[model samples]
Target: MALALLHTSPVHVPVFDALRDAHHPGFPLRHVVREELLAGAAARGPEAVAGEVTALVAELAAGGAAAVLCTCSTIGAVAEAAGSALAVPVLRVDRPMAAAAVRLGRVTVLATLASTLAPTRALLAEEARAAGLPGGDVRTVLVEGAWERFAAGDHDGCLDLVAAAADAVTGADVIVLAQGSMAAATARTTTALPVLSSPRPGLAAAVAAATRAAR
Candidate 1:
């Protein structure tokens, strides 16, 4: 079965490709990237943002995708809500990460974009509540000045800033990299705490869901 990934940026292409090769070898993939989707969502209101995500999900469904993974945390809720109306599973790429974080108790969500922190925290809270996990403190730490470097294509520098922030985090049961783009930074980080990134867990969840649905 084929799979489609809706991304807000091309930065995640390589990461997803590697992940697909490793986890779901030979699965045909289709990627639809709207580099400005997140930036545009800011100027647009909630309805517009939801509409954009819904439309993307529909397109993926129409393209024969057995499942769709929305790889943007900021618009994750919209994608998930849209999933309810579709036959195929449409999952937020961070859904698994959020679920994992909830089980870990004290969680620190690390992000480069301030916009993602709120939604990610909300997702973690929602996941925890659903699982009957006790309400735990979920804090957010934004890497100062990191987004600008990423916007400018200095990915190495951006990862450096994120790694520094991850290294400094203490006392959290788990550290979550808020964006799929930030997943690469996990390799650079050195910490005793479990550090979670979205791509692997999220894609694995999507594959499992899609496979079950197909059967």
Candidate 2:
């Protein structure tokens, strides 16, 4: 199987690679990282973001990818909307995690980037509605100074900040890591609430979707 992953940060590559190796061994993976997408989304607006995602999805399909997974929460809606027009499946990496959050009732979504909060919250709402569940209370917490730590190449520090934030979250049925890059921090956190991250679940879904497409 050939799965293409669209990421807004290069940090997600190794995380996805390890997950893919452990879960879907022998599957060929193609990674496309566009750091600009994350940095420019707010200034570019939704329409521009949608256009960029649409083009990227098409490009991935043309490259013989059976499925494309968008790993950026900020552009998740755009990728999902673009999927309707493509034969190959296009999925947002956070979809499975978002749906899981809805099922858990009250979800607290944590993100290092402020841009991720709105889309992650929106996705959880959409999933809840589609599942015929009562709209759950989805809260967002932006980890202070986390993005700066990441910008400074302090990967461990950034992850520690995220895990610390997760550890402190209370009164939620689940804690959701809003970005693929945040998935690594999940292992280091000790939380009473279930903490969910995108990579493993997302790649599992991608493998399934690509398998179906191949058939």
Candidate 3:
């Protein structure tokens, strides 16, 4: 079955590319974006800035999509609300990352997109509760322009920014790459701690959901 993946930036293309590259026929994928969708995710409050995502998802559904997967980590609630509103499988990419991050106990989420961290935190808290794990002590460090470099194919520049972000997560047991696009440079990551990316977990869940729905 085919899937419709939506995002607001081409910066996230690497993520969906990796997902489809690994999980082919079982999860054939297509992507669409509206650049303006990311306008406030790096600045305004989550509720105020990220609202455009849900609106766009609503529009994507009218075109006969079987399920909707939102790619932006910062605008998760808007995506979550859209999922509930549409009564379809609406999987926000960060939900899986947040759920798994909390399992590592004291964890730090390295987020380059500043605007989306709040809702992403809420998703992490919810994941903690579902796991019956104690509430987590989570910290966020934002790396400015990291995604831009990665999308531009500046491999070294992306890793350098991540190395700097790593310093922010020093005390934590694990550092979760807040942006899936940033996962491309995991090899150059200097942090000794295990680094987690959003795509592996998020795509796993979306594949499971889409598979079940297709069956």
Candidate 4:
């Protein structure tokens, strides 16, 4: 059985591919990238793309994908709701990371996109509830100008800003980098607080779910 991944940015293709190769070698992966999906979500909100997201997920599941992973945080809730309706395993990449964060007490979330903050916070709250914890104490920080730098192809500049934002955070038990692309910023942060990013844990969960479905 193969795992399917839905990504908004082409940058994530190689990142997840490499992760799968190293940790789950020989696993089959099908990647679908549609930049416009994220653009639409950012412009009009995730609900605006609910129909399309569900349709694409249904198509992938029907095509023999054991599990589908939505790597875009902006549209994650919609994708997950679609999965529930269709009886397919549709996992959001930020979930496992959010689960980890909720367990750590106060969480400070850092994001480059304005659209990512709400979804990430909501995911953390959901995870907290699922874990039988009180709704989490979550704070969101937007790294100003970082998204523009990323869009302009200045990846280093974007990450630099993200790292700076992470370093400035305080009174938090952990810091969560909201986007998979922001994972690189973790290395650049000097904060003593644990920093969490979705890609590694998320992909691992996807692999496990696909394996279970294949059985």
Best model number under TM-score: 4
Worst 10 residues of 1 by lDDT: 40-49
Candidate 2, residues 80-150: lDDT per residue as tens digits?
89989999999998999888889878888999989888888788888999999986687899999998999
Q: By TM-score, how accurate is candidate 4?
A: 0.98
Q: Report residue 175 deviation for candidate 2 (angstroms).
A: 0.5
Q: Which should have the higher TM-score, number 2 or number 4?
A: 4
Model 3 spans > 4 angstroms off = 49-51, 144-155
- Going through the candidates in the order shown, the clash numbers are 0, 0, 1, 0
Poorest lDDT segment (10 consecutive residues) of candidate 2: 42-51
Which segments of candidate 1 are over 4 A away from where they belong? Answer: 43-47
List the candidate numbers ranked by TM-score, top first.
Answer: 4, 2, 1, 3
**lDDT ranking, high to low:** 4, 2, 1, 3
Question: What TM-score does model 1 achieve against the real structure?
Answer: 0.95
| Candidate 2 local Cα displacement, residue 63, angstroms | 1.6
- lDDT (C-alpha, whole model) for all candidates: 0.86, 0.88, 0.73, 0.93
Candidate 3 lDDT, 1-215, residue by residue in tens: 55678777786676677667876544577688766666765555556654566677777666656677877776767777877877458888878877778888777777666665676677778889999987568887778878677667786787788867775467888887776667765666767888888777787787777777667
Off by over 4 Å in 2: none
TM-score of every candidate = 0.95, 0.96, 0.86, 0.98
